[model samples]
Target chain A: MKKLINQPEDAVKEELEGVAAAHGDRLRVHTAPNYIVRADAPVHGKVALVSGGGSGHEPMHGGFVGLGMLDAACPGEVFTSPTPDQVLEAAKAVNGGAGVLLIVKNYSGDVMNFEMAAELAEDEGIEVEQVVIDDDVAVKDSLYTAGRRGVGATVLAEKICGAAAEQRWPLPDVAGLCRKVNANARSMGVALTSCTVPTAGKPTFELADDEIELGIGIHGEPGRERRKLAPAHAIVETLATAVVKDLPFGRGDEVLAFVNGMGGTPLMELYVVYNELHTLLEGWGIAIGRNLIGSYMTSLDMAGCSITLLRLDDELTAFWDAPVNTTGLRWGV
Target chain B: MRDTVTQGGLTAWLRAFAAAVARDREELTDLDAAIGDADHGSNMDRGMQAVVGKLGGLSPDEAGVGVGALLKTVGMTLVSTVGGAAGPLYGSLFLDMGKAAGEDAELTVAQWATAVEAGVRGVQARGKAELGDKTMIDALAPAAEALSAAAACGLSLADALRRTAEAAAQGMKATTPLVARKGRASYLGERSAGHQDPGATSSWLLMQAAAEALASDAPPDRPRT
Candidate 1:
């Protein structure tokens, strides 16, 4: 396959080295393999927050690493998970007696790995708690369903959980908050084009010039269905409708909305999506308490977008508004 | 046909599998970029490399941790390290495998099969795209099904793996004419009908490695030239 790189195997390592070199001041490199932890991890007696997965979803787990987000992020090869050693090391390094909290998405691999880390930490008397966020509303639970997908909400979870950890709340409390965010949030996405894997040197799937996949997850998992391209407002309606049904928004409940772009899609498209979503929410009589618009979490350069909404309460609102100094989502101290 | 899968054999199997992924990462990724995310090869390669790194001093005391623990670690790593859909899909596979393997010091052949079955189920559950969707399930489902059938046939562990790999290869190839139903290619609707699925292709690599490295004794059919 033809692409810009010295060698296929060296791609991840080489790229990580570049990332470390660029963000070294704010992040520390993990030696077991390619991983990054916030420079201020452990923060004396503070609870540590660690989250990660594959590399292609840049500014995601890695970009979210900072004071209010992840204490450490173990970068796996492009679209791969980081190994246990890297996670274990991060756990140990970030542990400062107060315990650590793991924020994981709803995907099976992420859930399993984070759970394993918690077990290892407990083996060493380091208290650890984990919360898996399954917030996507696109795919329904069928006879072979694995529940909801974790889409745009992961960024919100990280930011809110990081805020909680920053407050030095006990592990259980912070973990609870992460779970709440997960439960309260829902996301749905769609894609227009397929992204080519760096190593594979081809698109993961084929997309006709005229069609699009709706209810797509960040990972390129199959969405609800494929149809000919439609207007921006129509797509927005489709995504929001699923989310609204899943969450069944209360009559006057406050909501936090996020319109996230899937890599290839530009701000222009996302803004168009956001405008449609805003109008739809208004029609539904749902009040938006907060909003995030951009590629907080993405699927390479796939041309698509996902919309996420969090049902906010006083506690969650406070946490959401708290300071998150990560590279991706940074605001409100 | 041994009824059990020894820890040593399992370890050897995993090590070899990890190495195989490391070796063919780019090829896998290249396949993925054709229809899905472009990072499968690199992502699996990265995850396997991490596994090798952690296996350096794996001790018996870690048994209470469960296969889920190791798999989960790999899953989390992938979520952060690897980008795109592969990280989550592969992560889910290992996560389910680890959950099934939980804290067991060693694995029986039946138990290993059960774990893989669980993992496969997990992938189907999470991704929602089925066997005909031209995703990894094309290869994975056939491998699991073949292994199950082989178990019933009372074949050796090696033979069972070989059969599974053979089935997986066939399944991978079966994707050529099917319209894409999952991942990015699903967007193509009718246009995606002719191309082979990248995820399914790499899924074959996983089974091929397992069959060759872990089940050499199986008298399974070889790929046709």
Candidate 2:
């Protein structure tokens, strides 16, 4: 329950205000329906890219909204999916003459809300295409459950698709690229300590000091299993093995390796994870062509990390290297 | 015993549901915490409060739009305010119900049965959750079936609604031992069993609210605790 906030109920709104203030030069924060769009939106001929989910995953949909990243992000309440109206408003705000692409995570709420928004947008005569990201390997069976929850791979898809859209790729082409990224990537996470949602006023789950939850999603949902806490190498091995084998990534395959911190984890630890992942992938004959090591996608103040590997080819690599400017991610600007 | 549900009665049903949600917010959160992220209670309560607030602020012309329009507005309000899986599911329910009810100012028992069935079907269509998927559909589908059956037998409005509430309550109880196959709880797989579904629990409350508000001659301004 102890954290920096004026009130639990006002947490999302206040944080959005802070984001608007800090990144006003690059993005514009809209309220009443609450969506963030690039400052100079409706970039004329370019297709717009929109993605969003619950509020706690910072620098995600919202922070990615600028330049060669997301054109708009609809942030919901903490740990909750944004509504259709918010999504619709965002689409309307950023839709250039080309069209709009919705990059949705594969949670039930996000899927349904985005679906509803797509329908509404179409009704308004706006062309819309949707690509769902369901790259988490934790949920083993799509048949038995609501399918895999989108995790680290969502960040990668957003960046690559944003680059494609920025290059004036058609809406369908950008959406197709997003779908290809989602199809090729796999992710898994391990949580050391439980996160406390501000409104809940307590830890999401009680993880014993000696135990860790494996295969966790970003929303603090219980994962595959809890086991005795192990060494960093063991944890990385577990995550990396799950991710690699799920895709069955093998020899001669090139990949974009992403080691993301789960909010509370430090950069130093993430690098440690990256170090282990690099050696492991090398041993497996998987070439790490490009790598991103940071807290780009995160759960709120959760002490954990996730690894995502997207099989890469020339097209994806070029898009990944495209010039971009955003508050959370920047490189070849 | 009311034979028809007036626009005022439908409003009272929503208000009663809102009050019940506010009262049991913590319990819903506890249920969700067992298998999913613990926000169902707070999210539902917030959405219900917004629906009530919107009702309070309706202009005279807006209020005069009849029961179906009012329900559609309520559905839209819930969709916008309630973030999570519950938002779209519940919003679809009310929206479908409103569509079924048409522009009628009041509805007979058979019409109410049709509306409930339509609402439940909308939920199924939106979530793609079938029976036994361990979702709100568990409670909602059965309640819709029971109401339809009661209407077929020419039962009174009160009697049909009472049966609907009982069916929903029984469905809620049944979820305690089943493994969830939808929503976040499904991520827990077998571990998700033994916890009553928070969405089903809230849906039962929704049916019970209808029993108390729409089926009785209760005043619109006075929703029961």
Best of the candidates, TM-score: 2
DockQ for each model: 0.11, 0.80
Docking tier of model 2: it is medium
lDDT of 1 at A214: 87
Candidate 1 docking: what grade?
incorrect
lDDT of 2 by residue, B139-184 (tens): 9999999999999999998889999999999999999999999998
Q: What is candidate 2's lDDT per residue for A121-201, written digit by digit as tens?
A: 999999999998999998899999999989888999999999998889998888889989999999999999888888878
What TM-score would chain A of each candidate receive against the reference chain A? 0.95, 0.99
RMSD of each: 7.8, 2.2
Clashes of 2: 0
> Which residue pairs collide, candidate 2?
none
Candidate 1 structure quality by residue, lDDT tens digits, A248-323: 8766878998998888889999999989988988888888899988887878778999899999888888888887
lDDT of 1 by residue, B1-225 (tens): 334554444445567778777777777756655555555676667666766655555544442344446556555555445444665577678778878877765566677788889889988876777878778899999899888888777777778888899999899889989877565566445666777787887778778877766543232122123
lDDT score, candidate 1, position B139: 91
